[model samples]
Target: MIRTSAAALAFLVAALPATAGERMNLGIGTIFDNDAMGDGDDRWRSGSFAISHFRGPEWRGKLPEAPGSFIEWRFRSEIITPENVSGTAITSDRRYVGVLSAGLHTHFQRNGAEVSLGADIVAIGPQTGLDDFQDAVHDLIGTSEPRSAVNQIGNDIVPTVTLEVGRELALAGNGHVRFRPFVEAQAGIETLVRIGGDFTFGGTGMGAFRMRDVVTGQRIDGVIGTADTGLSFLVGGDIAYVADSFYLPSRLGFDLTETRNRLRAGLQYDGEIASVFYGVTWLGEEFEAQPESQVVGTIAINLNF
Candidate 1:
């Protein structure tokens, strides 16, 4: 599957045309938390790199008067290494995520602002390395424990549909500085099947434990089943300084539920041919018991034809 996905991405990138007025962007960055510490469990070190392309109507006089539309596809991958693990032991995991979105954008001339409404389809796959953590827990805590059957704690493909609403405000100097803020909400069902050995412990000789969907309040049978729906919300803003031929973009944002806070600063040089951007990000992850953080730097090359 991984190979197939990689091949597909490569094919898509290669098939894209370099045409006038087309926009393409590629970025690579790491997320690190200076305070994240622990032997083997460096909670603060994880990152993802992505490439995106947007094609839309050109702007006139600082903002486009007519409404425009675009479709964007993003691919990202990240890895997380746990702390306090043993020698040559792999206690971390990796994730591959993809998002496809299409939206309509309108620039309000009177306000010097722009608004975008879009929908996104998201998919995530996790790759775990190491003994099933859930299995270890069951051996120690007993199968009857409420948490014993949560097998394969990390690996799964979660598909979701989300809605996004964002706006950009023009700041001082007509275009020298700008603030872009946006929010996204997502809700969908999560299906769990093919239980990992870690999720279940010895239980009344019943083989493995099972769980019902918390959202739909329905009993789930078979290895794979769908649960009730859940929602996630994100809010953030970017402050950018724009020049005739250069720009700088800074961002601060947070997400609810999962509790993610991020700060990013980067420099961008927009020339007649293409643009190059480099930046770093500080991200915090509020996981149970022990929260993790990371700091990462990124570089991106964009072509605006």
Candidate 2:
């Protein structure tokens, strides 16, 4: 898998236009998510953090029409654990897993549609040090120790490619209400096909660049801009059909749910010198033996003081 992914990345890099690397500095965006902010139950899909830096020739207030006109370098880390941290027994829950990924992506427009293409080299298992990190956090917070840490998923590297295409439709001439429907496909790590749509009820992010969150699929800003100073609302949902997953090792008899669903809503405030985004997402069952659904919260703040 590692060799294949490397070759795939090489092919992709070779296919880029000559000017892909020549661009000016743009902006940066960051996001953090945790189950603690939701139901306070830190279990599967526990937490994640992501930061992306974008560069281009200039800020055109919208995606450029040419391919590779804008580039984004993204870094992300994630930790997933079983339901009970201290339990040593073999439950039907998912094994502890840690992931760190870095990738390069391009955002562009073609024929009135928005497109993103990227590839990530995803590292999984204890090598990410997430198990130890989680232990330290738990110890500091006086939470239960991760007794089952020794039984986590083995280490592996997977090369994943992701592609998404969508078009934004302005439901209101003033840009108060807009809807964007998209289709996304992935190859590697967890292979799946997804279809979804997002709605914006205000002018917070109009004509701005936004990046989608991996876990919750929430679109967060990718570049700080002269946003309209006001409050905006977001609502979105998606359904995915999974073909395979590395997290659910077939040899271990872990059952993978064929269908997955997610629903999310958020509010954003762009003040004079600061901006804040807060959202909650409801995640449907991922495994057949899983107990129930879970809710997670996400937040992103930028202060330009």
Question: Best by lDDT, which number?
Answer: 2
Clashes of 1: 24
lDDT of 2: 0.84
What digit string (tens of lDDT, one per residue) describes model 2 on residues 183-299?
A: 999988899999999998998777677789999998877765565788889999999998888888877788878799999999987765556799999999898888899999999
Best by TM-score: 2
Q: Over the stretch 91-189, how does candidate 1's per-residue lDDT look in tens digits?
A: 232111212222121222224433332222223322432234423543696542212112213333333333333343434543234344444343322
State the displacement of the C-alpha of residue 269, model 2, in Å, after optimal TM-score superposition: 2.2
Model 2 Cα displacement at 171 (Å)?
A: 0.5
Q: Model 2: which residue pairs collide?
A: none
Q: Candidate 1's C-alpha lDDT?
A: 0.29
Q: What is the C-alpha RMSD of each candidate to the true structure, in Å?
A: 20.2, 2.0
TM-score of 1: 0.44
- At residue 103, what lDDT does model 2 achieve? 84
